[model samples]
Target: MISARERLLNYAILIVFSAAALFPMIGVVAQALQFPDLDAGTFRDAWREGHFGTYLRNSAIVTAVTVACASVLSIMAGYALGVLRLPGSEALFLLFLAGLTVPTEAVVIPLYFDLRTLGLDNTYAGVILPQVAQSVAFGTYWMRAYFRGVPRSLIDAARIDGASSWTTLWRVLVPMGRPAILTMVVLTSMWTWNEFLLPLVILNSDEGLRTAPLGLSFFQGSHQTDYALLTAGALIIAAPVVLLYVFLQRRFIAGMLSGAVKE
Candidate 1:
């Protein structure tokens, strides 16, 4: 039933749209490959000559911890709000929703002072806790939507089978919501991996911890006007996120669409 003219139009639209979206990435890769010509030898050299191995490892550590903490907490929080009939549930849920409206900058000042007082600054716990807090609201909202879509009949069946509350969540609800969990993992990993502002403020030492993103900034400052290396650093910072998205785009789409298609 497809016409030749319609096909041509579709291809034209795709070419235009895809080109626009791809231009930045195409340019970055080209520049990185060009080395200093694209930016500077020092900048490109930072990834090659500098301690990128350490930066990558630190980033992975922080991202893994953040994602794990956010996923478990979000799943439990969302399940509670979606399924439990406790009093003041609406108020507690609103608190979670409020997290979405909060701007990180607004809280950073207070956060910094608190961490300093508690001697958490320059520590992984300090870097991580704030990121987790920032992510919790969005995570809870996404998870709640997904959990809401799970059939209540499933919960009833689990109860009839004498499954405990925790057992039901783990054995039944969590399994059914794999799509949403994968989506959360992707989102949290990307966010933690690329986070800058909070890390910049909370972290004081370059020793034992320097995220890839933080290192990119340091690389830029040290390299001065090196654009090629800048691109290379960007590639380094972006690689994991890009790879994960490419591999998991299907689950991402399914999770996000699951939220939208449900009530």
Candidate 2:
């Protein structure tokens, strides 16, 4: 157990880091609120002029589709790798794990050409598909570890009850794995929403298809000197991710702690 002195020291460190992170955000918020007649009109003007409404919609669609597809694929792949007895499953799992090591920048240039060859460039499909692939890679790794850590007795009991693999996974393991799964979804959503490079390369021409981060970059370029509009636009783009983290904080923390304990 931690002593009172250790706890106090830990809190002190956290406070220091928390203030470091919040200081910039406080400045940005203050700038947003203080400029342009010292009111909230900056946000409205930034919203209208920056055309973030369309960008937000595109980002929402891409993120939703990518997360949903990646989660389903991850769960299935993880289940197969973690529990099922198949030939060369270990090698297959390692292949998925290898994807986690490959940096996005290394393949992004080639990916652009490949997508262009497939005539998917400048389209929502182009952006969403690549991000979905990236998300699935990490998601598979995450879910596989969680499923592999499940007790053998629990799985055996489910099988003894004459449950099929599908039923066992959905009815038994899935319910028990809610925290892990929710954590994975939240992480994937955050990654997908914040993704900029894939969208930037794939969506060169279609402004309507730009994700929030990409749109924010373009907005910044046009409003180079306008800090208020820039900060407000950033806040608008970042709000969804912040709200998501806030709402899922408990589940995310539980999942992370459980994973750490298991490790």
Candidate 3:
């Protein structure tokens, strides 16, 4: 912990990884602003050519709703697994984990046909419903790990105080789970926001349903030569995640630690 040489090496590694991860985003910014001169015209070109406003609003809506659903579902399912001593619980938990292994593509063909039958294809709910299902598997796993770390005495005390299961979960466990909850929110938001394959497969209309990722595809197709607009679209999609991580780094790290370092 006190080695200067080790710290230096770590920083060096960080710089290298940071550059590698940031380049694609930087490249997109360079293209969106389209200043071959790389000057002040970036915003002007982006606003003129990109439908960033619409895409931004759409991404916000879908990401918010789906994440809300995923976080709620994960927290409840995770608590049930971590503390509830129901019969055959281990086998049922395995079932949830098994859902993690099933590829979304394998299910998409059946999903599409079913959605079409229900007239849900191209609907906002259709796009979000499948993503919620996918996110729940991983979310439940992570939240379960977090919940397992919480002291059982806390639950016992709550129960002794005449707290019902629902009261204990909401009033005690949920508050203690702030870090894990935030982590769930961030993960689900990013996954849903960046999701392209699902939206592309489920949605066929440009009318009321195009996620930012899917919209970016449309932008790229229409303006293949217009690197500036494409770059702007890319930035529009990426900015929120970057800002979220930067601002919530503490909570993210804390949540991850709570989940992984269970006693």
Candidate 4:
């Protein structure tokens, strides 16, 4: 059992980190709302001037496709490695794990050229494909760990009941694994939505193909001296991710903590 003192210390640490994380956001909100005359209609003007509608559409398309593809691929790969224990699975798992160690910057130059050769550069596909690959690497590791923790008896019982591996996974395991799956989705969504570097490198030539973070950068450059507009644009770009976490906080926390205790 955790001691009272330990619990208190943990809470204190969390509180400190939470405040540290939130302080800048609070400052941005304050700046966004300040100097009524100068700041008046700043967000609206920035939105229109930056052509955020186009950027948002591009971001939505990239993030949605990336997350959807990554989630499905990760789930399937996780099942194979974690449950089926496919031949050479450990080597395959390690190969996927290698992706986590490779920094994006190291590969972006080669990736840019590859996408250009494929005629995908300056296109949403160029940004979406790389981010999807990154998300799947992490997602497969996460889901595999969660799946491996399932009871052997449960899996055996599913097999005894004449269920195919696909049915057993989708019906038996996936239902029980909702928390883990939802957590992965929420995380992947956040990463995809906030992605900047890939979009910057791949879609530099196309303003209409820019994602939210990329658009915000250009917005900042244009409004270099306008703190209010800059802050407002930042908030606008971040609001979707914030709202996603707000709605899924419970499942996200539960999924993160579920592995802490074992039966």
Winning model by TM-score: 4
Across 119-226, the per-residue lDDT of candidate 4 in tens digits comes to 999987899899989999999998898888998899999999999999999999999998999999998998899888888899979888899999999988988987
Regions of candidate 1 where Cα sits further than 4 Å from its true position = 1-23, 33-44
Clashes by residue pair, model 3: 31-228, 32-228, 35-38
Per-residue lDDT of model 2, residues 228-249, tens digit only: 7788898999899989999999
Which residue segments of model 3 deviate by more than 4 Å?
1-20, 29-45
Worst 10 residues of 3 by lDDT: 31-40
For 117-139, candidate 1 gives per-residue lDDT tens digits of 99998888888998888788888
Task: Give per-residue CA lDDT, model 3, range 174-241, as digits (tens).
Answer: 99889888877887887888888888888877545777778778878888876655665566678888
For each candidate, what TM-score against the reference? 0.86, 0.91, 0.87, 0.95
User: Cα RMSD to native, each candidate?
Assistant: 3.8, 2.1, 2.8, 1.7
- The candidate with the higher TM-score, 2 or 4, is 4
In model 2, residue pairs whose N, Cα or C atoms come closer than 3 Å (at least 3 residues apart or on different chains), thus clashing, are none
Q: What are the lDDT figures for the candidates, one per model? A: 0.83, 0.89, 0.81, 0.88
**Best of the two (2, 3) by lDDT:** 2
Residue 203 displacement in candidate 4 (angstroms): 0.3
Report how far residue 70 has shifted in candidate 3, in Å: 1.0
**Residue 191 of model 4, lDDT score:** 87
